[model samples]
Target: MRLCVPRAGDPATATAPVAVEVAAHLLGLVGDPATATVAWDIDWQGPLSVPLTDEHAVQAACGIMHVHGRAAGRPAPLAVDYASTVAGVLAAQGVCAALLARAGGADVTRVRTSVGQAALLALAQYLAAATADGDDPEGCPPSRADAGQELVPAACSFVSADGVCFELEALDAERWLDFWRLLGVDRADTGRGWRSFQQRFATATCALPPVLSATVRRASFTAVRSAADRAGATVLPVRQDPLPPTVTPPWTLTPFPEPGGTTIDRDGTAAAPLEGLRVVESARRVQGPLAGHVLRLLGADVVRIEPPGGDPMRGVPPMAGTTSARFSALNAGKAVTEIDFTTDAGRRAVRDLVSEADVFLHNWAPGKAVRLGLDADDLRAARPGLVYAWASGWGDALGPEPPVGTDYLVQAHSGLAAAVRPADEPPAPSLMTLTDVLGGLVCAQGVLAALLTRLHTGRGARVDSSLFSAAVLVPRGPGRPAATGRPLHTRDGYIALGPRARQRPERLAPALGLAASASADAIASRARTRPTAHWLPRLAAAGVAVTPVCTSLADLARDPRFAPALTVGEYAAPLAPWEFS
Candidate 1:
């Protein structure tokens, strides 16, 4: 699949992940050849070539594997193909964005992305926290991260006396304290545990006091749930349901009452596809902000709409400058305006902003938009060509009174917990906020698709995405056990073998001075006899791709291959995952 770039010095040809490229040309899509899309599992040519597999992507990117391993209390690989799937989704999104750029008279010719980069993007928040300046900010949660261990134990995903393993969520410390106190926990332990649990979404580690887990361990699931209900918290049992026969796409684009009514009037720019476009984003936490950030990366003018005091997360721990590194990672380079949406005047202010904006986005809980008179109908009435987006926890999936639509709860409810880990390990939700990131990407993708659709229809569309939808995309995969796809344990650290080595283990056995055929245990024992450095070159010489497991995200900046994927600033941040070659 050649991506026919028109510009000289641009990529003359590119291929693999053929659907997007094929769709662009076959559908008579016209964009600067510069905006054509191509994707791959990994770069075909690099300083060093690694095998193309989800395992390698996660391990090398310092991605979700580290967080999953921590939650599972071991150096375990996830059973599902998360990185590759996300990469594919992102590739499709790039195609839509490129097409949108063309409609807006922008020259976007060649878009390139890889599973490795997508994996890095998925771990952006953790990467931010890892490279932040100073200790955690004041009033922040207690962090108990241990750099020495391959997997740090997390006090998330509790099991009840009735054998029900479930996820628990509380947005505020007060509710967290109340829930545990109702469960008969000591006030001191609950206080300490709240810090770790509250920050788990930011730091991938939750070292809660053992007493918290113990308290829940002695209670029935019903009793635990009763406490959560009374405290305005939420608890969801880990479901082991079969994959739905039909999974909904993570987001949908729908034209409103009319079509072919509008086209953006701004002049397009050469530097980025979405340049000159304005995105008015009113969002909290990761999902909505992440969607807006994606647009910012694509060169849109993203104006963040915050409450009067500004987002409280500005002070979240591991500060980069004045704001939390995690917040900076998602919202840097975007403009911010504080509007007290609780007042009618604030709603009017947002409406005024929306009057000239290309996109209006939010991630408020269900029905909040309607209650605030900012629903799609309300705002689109003011600006008929507006692309309205809602990035939420659930997209009308669980009805009006849904359980909190947070990432971990969605994971448990959708059986993602079971899908991500082996059967032997108890169902555990990775603290990496996987669904939230994916949902945000889904939201951005939907918005781009809607924008592209508006090119013909001349009307703006409503886009919706949720963590629940994202979770469904990854059903209960028959995950690999802890024994499968494990890295070789060397004296110094671990080194992951590439797809080629795993596929042809017989060849690898001889390189390790083993019999013609080696059992995994024999090879593991032999590999441990030497240091990681000693084994890497020898394995490479024998045609086995290898890389050190990026157990620590702080070290990711030092890996040469990832240089293009990150920028070392006040804190480390992932670059836009796609490359316009």
Candidate 2:
């Protein structure tokens, strides 16, 4: 792919990841490079361009087509102010991309539509804010402009007319086009005479001409609008809810001085941002363990305290020589020890660990945690400065919902399963453990944020996260149910439709499907004819919903974008040991 290197004095100068402190913030739905698929397998170890694989290109193309389709619905000489419209679109796309990346979608069509709608929503909110703010709101704060600027509280909000709302003023079209180019969207119109000439010869996949992608997206939305108008329907505009205010942070951040006693190893890693901080991990399974992993990533020394039987996730599928890849993905790169917190001795061990620990992460049942003396009060009584992190299946600790949860169980419980299946077919839980991974990522962010808070305040606080809550948080959906019910699928279900409308019910049915009927069976039969790879692109063209079935962990490993998970279970150490100092 081609790249359009910014001029020497460009505002978004590339910097080390730590320089961009909230690098993870830039990575998700909130940032400009609003992406759909994360290219999870991409070698995240190095720079952006060298690893420009096919998956990255496909993902980028998908995002461009989606934006274009949305723009096609709009009228030409679009009344949208250039900067504001594009900014709105970028904001929406950022959230959509983050969702899509965190939870892989079923079909390409939904991916595109969801992304476009999300982009529109984000854009709408931004413009509404800008219009409310009387036009220019300090011309898009520097942090919003730069990919590398540290994203602290001061940088999170823009000065709005009413007060300080956590929204930005909108951007006009020309500036929007520039933003698109910076994000690597492809387009034919560069608008600048010789400037167009300059980027014409560049690689199409590397970096899109900002103006080009914007124009293309505008055209696509115009077409979509025209089609709707011809069908005798007025297009309804999309809107988004206000983002949650940063409250009750999960963890705190503490910048560390260079190590004086320990030997330094800075060859390829980011600076040890939390070199002297200590994190005590009591979490089992992915969500809580992953929080500790994130702390370790930022240079904190993480001490993982596993129960005697080890984490239950160790028994999860896709194991290698009896070890679970699922467990390894979240638990690697930390020092591990075994403890039994249920016993007084075990509780004492935990207290000793917490006395020197800056953060503590766990996923035990909430009430059980308190009964077992692992509650915030019990632990804090021993160590006041400790940041307690708790991840669970549901949201019982605070607002709505109760404990008793699992990743897949939560997917079925939280209406995520409802969203994934085809409208006509039996509900099928997602092939991937979305709640597990998404919750893990969020828990990690919470832990880090809480850490940052500890840096400012001498006191520590309890930070709680859960799969039930996170599932609701990450996926755009409705509020909690007054009373909970049993999860839908204790077993797997299927979704399929034959090429013809009248396929036999017997042929379409899964060998032993859950909640399958004759009608559902017919749908499944038709579904089988169109393998995931073939159906994804076709459904996108037809505007139908679909979900690609990933049969095995190996299938995912085969995809280059998923390489990080491949060596997850290979935890053996080198034969010869080396010294740190």
Give the TM-score of each candidate.
0.87, 0.43
- Candidate 1: 10-residue stretch with minimal lDDT: 39-48
On TM-score, the leading prediction is 1
What is the per-residue lDDT of model 2 for residues 468-512, given as tens digits with 9 covering 90 to 100? 555554322233211111011112321222222122334223332
What is the C-alpha lDDT profile of model 1 across 1-581, one tens digit per residue?
34433244322122223223323432232223433343222232112233433445455435456655654444456676676556656666666666666767776665666666677778777788878876642113343542332222563488899989888999998999999999988887677666667777776667767787788889999999999999999998887652532366667777787753355554765567787788999998999999999899987899999888889999977788888888898999999999988898999999999988989999998889999999999999778878999998878788777878999888787777767766666667777687888888878877877777677768888988888887776534444344356667788777777777767788788777789677988998999899888887787787777767766677766666667667998888878877654
- TM-score, prediction 1: 0.87
Candidate 1 ranges with C-alpha deviation above 4 Å: 1-58, 72-75, 136-152, 242-246, 259-261, 266-269, 475-483, 500-509, 515-522
Residue 460, model 1: lDDT of: 88
List where candidate 2 sits over 4 angstroms from the true fold. Answer: 1-272, 312-322, 397-403, 426-428, 475-581
Question: What are the clash counts of all predictions, listed in order?
Answer: 11, 53
Provide the RMSD of all predictions against the true structure, rounded to 1 decimal: 4.9, 24.8
